[model samples]
Target: MLKKFAKQTLVAVSLAVSIPVFAASYTIGTGSQSGTYYPLGGILAKIWSENIDDFDMRAEVTAASVENTIKVATGKQLVGIAQGNVVLQANEGVKPFPRKMDVSVLFALYPNAVQFMVPADSDIHSISDLKGKRISLGAPGSGTRVSSVNILSTLGINESDVKPQSLNYTATTNALANGQIDAGVIVGSLGVGAITELALTRNIRILSFSEDDMQKIIAANPSYQPLEAPAETYKNVPAFTTPAVWNVLVVNKNMPQEQAYEMTKVAFDNMKKIRQVVGVTKFTTLENMNKLSGIALHPGAQQYLDEQMKK
Candidate 1:
C-alpha cells in the first residue's frame, strides 16, 4: 500500500510539472515567401524555440510589414516584423494604422534601404524621372510598396501619373532584367542578395534621388534616414549612395512580459550571430535599441533596456 501511494504521488507531481509546459505557444508573423522578413523571422523563431523555456514557437510568412503589424496589433500573431517607418506610422495612427496600434517594440532589428533599381539603359535618373515609366512599386500591402508611394508622393507623382506594378522582388527583378519593367523598388537590409545578384547577372543601375528631392523626402517622413549605399554593397554598382530607413521588430501589447524580456535579451546576446544572418550594423546597439525604438518598448523589453542602459 505504501509503495502504491508513493507511485501515485510521483505521477501527480509529473502531471503538475507538465501542465505549465504546454501553457505557451507563440507564432511569429513574417513577410512574403521570398523576402528578407520571412527568413529573419524563421531564424528568430528557431532561436526562441531552442532557448526559451517551455515555449513553442514558429514563424509564418504573411503579406509583409503592414499585414504583419496588423497581425501583431490584433493578437493574430504574438510577434512580427515591421518597417521602422511603418511602426512609427502605425503607432501614431497614420496611413494604414486606421486607429493607433498598440504594438510594442522588441528591437530595432535592421537597417533596410530604399533600393530603387533601374535598367542599365534606362534614362530615368531620379525619382522624378520615373514619372512616366513602368515601375514595380513592390507587391501590394508591402512596406516596400508603401515606401515607394511615399517617394512618389515626394516627387508630386501619385498613383495616377505612373504605371505602378505590384510585384514581389523575384518577379520585379525578372521583369526589370527582361525589359518587362523599367524599374523596381525594394526595402531591404544593406546587402540585399537579390539586388546584388541581379546587378551581377545583368546590367543594372542603382537609382539616386537628387539632394533637394532627398531633403523633401526627409521632411515628409522623419523616420527615413540618409544612408550611403557604398559601392561595395553591390558589384560594379559604382560608388553610389542613397537615403533609406530601418526595419523594426514589434510585438502585440498583450505579449507576456517575461516572454518579451527573454526575446529582448536573446536578440542582444546573440546579435553577433544575427549580424551573420542579416547584414545589419549600427541598429543592434543597446543605446539605439532604447533611444530609437520605432514604437513603445514592451514593459519586459523595457526591463532589458534598463539593464543595458545601466551597464
Candidate 2:
C-alpha cells in the first residue's frame, strides 16, 4: 500500500509538470475617448482577453495616432493604432519622431478622412479661401496636424498666411460654434461624432479639394489618397473630395511571434463582430491586410497571413 501511494504521488507531480502555464498581459494604445480608436481598442481587448487562454489585455486612451505610434515603439504599450503616413514617417525618423522606431504592422484598420469644416455662412469656400482667416489645425502632436500642415504647404499657404489655432476635435467644434475659428481640420472616419454634434446645431460646410490641389497633395505625400465624404453624411451636406490616410495596427518589434500571430488571428476571425463596434472594420480586408506602408509586417502576422492564404 505504501508503494502504490508513492507511485500515484509521482504521477501527479509529472502531470502537473507537463501542463503548460501561460500568463501574459498586454496593453493596446488607442486615441481619445471621443474617437473611434478608443472604443475599437476596447472591443479588441475584450475579444483577446476572452478568446486567448491566460491572456490579460487592456486599452489605453492616448493623444491619438502619433502618440500611439511612439508609445508602441518605445514599449510603453504592446500595440497601437496609427495613421499610415505617420507610421511611415516614424519608421523614417521624421519631424514628429526623434528617430526610426522598431515597429511592425499588424494590419490596416481604416481610412481617416481629412475633413475640413467651416460654418455654413463662412466666406471660406475652398482650401484657398482660408488665407487670412483663423483655422484650427488639430492639436500640435496629433496626426491631423501633420496632415494639415502638409496640405497647407503643398498649396503654398505659409503659416504666416493664416492664424492657426491648435485645438482638438471637440474644442474645434466649440470654437466654430462660438465664432472663435473660421475653419477646422478634423481627421476621422465618415460621420465622426464630433462633427455630427456640431452639425446638429450649427450649419457646417465640408471643404472639397480641387483637382489641382488634390494632385499637389498626392505629389507631396503618396500615402494620402483621394476620398469622398458621401452626401447626406451630415445635414444638408453634399459629397465632397478630400485626402485620406489608412490607420494601421502596429506592434513593437520585440513582441513574441506566437502572441502577435494569435492576436492577428483573433482580430481577423472576429472581424464581423468587431465591425459592429468599429465602423472602420469594413476596410480591414485581406487586401488591406497585405498593404503595409513603409513599415514591415510582424513575422507572426505574416505567418498568419500565409496560413490564411492556404485556406
Candidate 3:
C-alpha cells in the first residue's frame, strides 16, 4: 500500500503542466456520512485526483444509490456509487425514474448486505412481528430503503401496517440505541462502522428471512443473492441469513471514452486503497468487473476491462 501511494505521489509531483490553474471539476455522488459509500467515495476521489491531472475531483455526501443514479444520468454528477438493482431499474425505465436513464458502468463496487437488525431482547422476532413497531427503513432515495421495502412487500407487509422511519445509517443506529425505534434495516458492507459501534453498546440481533421466503424473493429478483451475516461481524451478534446486492460504479453515458478508460484503469491499478475501504471492497477488482446486468458499460471502461481479461 505504501509503495503504491509513493508511486502515485511521485507521478503527481513529476507531471509538467501549462494548463489553467482552475482546469475543470467533477463530483462523485456518495451516501450519508455514516455509511460506507461516503468513505469509499473519498478513496475513489483521491485516486482520481492524484492520477488524473487538471481536474478538481471530489466526493460529496448525498442520498445514496437511487439519488446517485439520477444525478449521474442527468449529468448533475460525473460519477457515482449505486446499487446494481437500482441502476437496472433506471436502465429499464422503471417507476421512480420517469424515463430510461442514460448511464454507463465503470466496474462493480461491493456487495451491500440487507442488515435487518433489532435489539436482542426485543419481541420482534420476525418480519411479521414488525407490523406495529417503529422501524427505520433507511433514508429517502436510498438503496437501503429499496431493499427494506422489497423485503416488507415480499413478506406481505405494507408501509401503513408499521410506523416507518426514513433515517440514514447513523440516525438509524442512534435511534435504535436510544430506544426510539424497535428495528432498522441498513444495506451496507459487513463490518459497517455504524453497526459496529452500536454493537459495542447494545447487543443486537441480525434478523433473517424465513428459508422458504428467501428462495421466493431470490427467484423474483435475480440481482439480489442469498447472503449470510456471520456471528463475527459484531459483538455477540448471531449468524443470520439475508439478501445482498452488488453496488456498481457508474458515470453519465456522455463521458468521453478515453476519460472513462483512464478512470477505470486508475481504479484497478490502485485497488489496494479501495480494498482497504471495507472488507467487501476486496471484490472490486478486474475479475468482478462485469457482474451487474442490464446497465451498459462505458465504452472506455469496457475496453480496459476486456484488455485485462486477455492477459
Error of model 2, residue 25, in angstroms: 3.6
Highest TM-score: give the candidate number: 3
Q: Write the per-residue lDDT of candidate 1 for residues 1-311, one digit (tens) a residue.
A: 99999999999999998875463788888876567787788878877777777767888877688988988899888888878788787888889678999788877766778889987678987777888789999887789999989878877999889888999888888898899988899888776667877877887778876788788888888788777777767766765556677677888877889888998898778777766776554467876774444457889998999987888
* Clash tally, candidates in order: 0, 0, 0
Roughly what TM-score does model 3 have, to 2 decimal places?
0.91
lDDT of 1: 0.80
Backbone clash total for model 2 is: 0
Candidate maximizing lDDT: 3
- Is candidate 1 or 3 superior in lDDT? 3
| Model 3 local distance difference test score | 0.88
Q: Estimate each model's TM-score.
A: 0.89, 0.90, 0.91
State the lDDT of candidate 2 residue by residue for 1-311, as single tens digits: 99999999999999999998875888888876766788889999999989999888899977787888898899888899878888898889888889988888998888999999998887888998989989999987788888888889899997789999989888888999999989999988887788888888989889999999999899888998999778889888778999999888988888899989999999999888899987768989877885656667889998998898898
lDDT of 3 at 114: 91
Please write out the lDDT profile of model 3 over residues 1-311, one tens digit for every residue.
99999999878776745334774788999998888999999988988888888867899999999999999999899999999988888888886689999987889988888988899999988888999899999999999998899878888898999999999999999999999999999998888888989999998898887888788788878898888777878899988888888999978888999999999999889988777765578888787788887666889999998898899
**Candidate 1: minimum summed lDDT over ten consecutive residues — where?**
287-296
Q: Give the number of colliding residue pairs in candidate 1.
A: 0
In candidate 1 the C-alpha lDDT for residue 180 amounts to 93
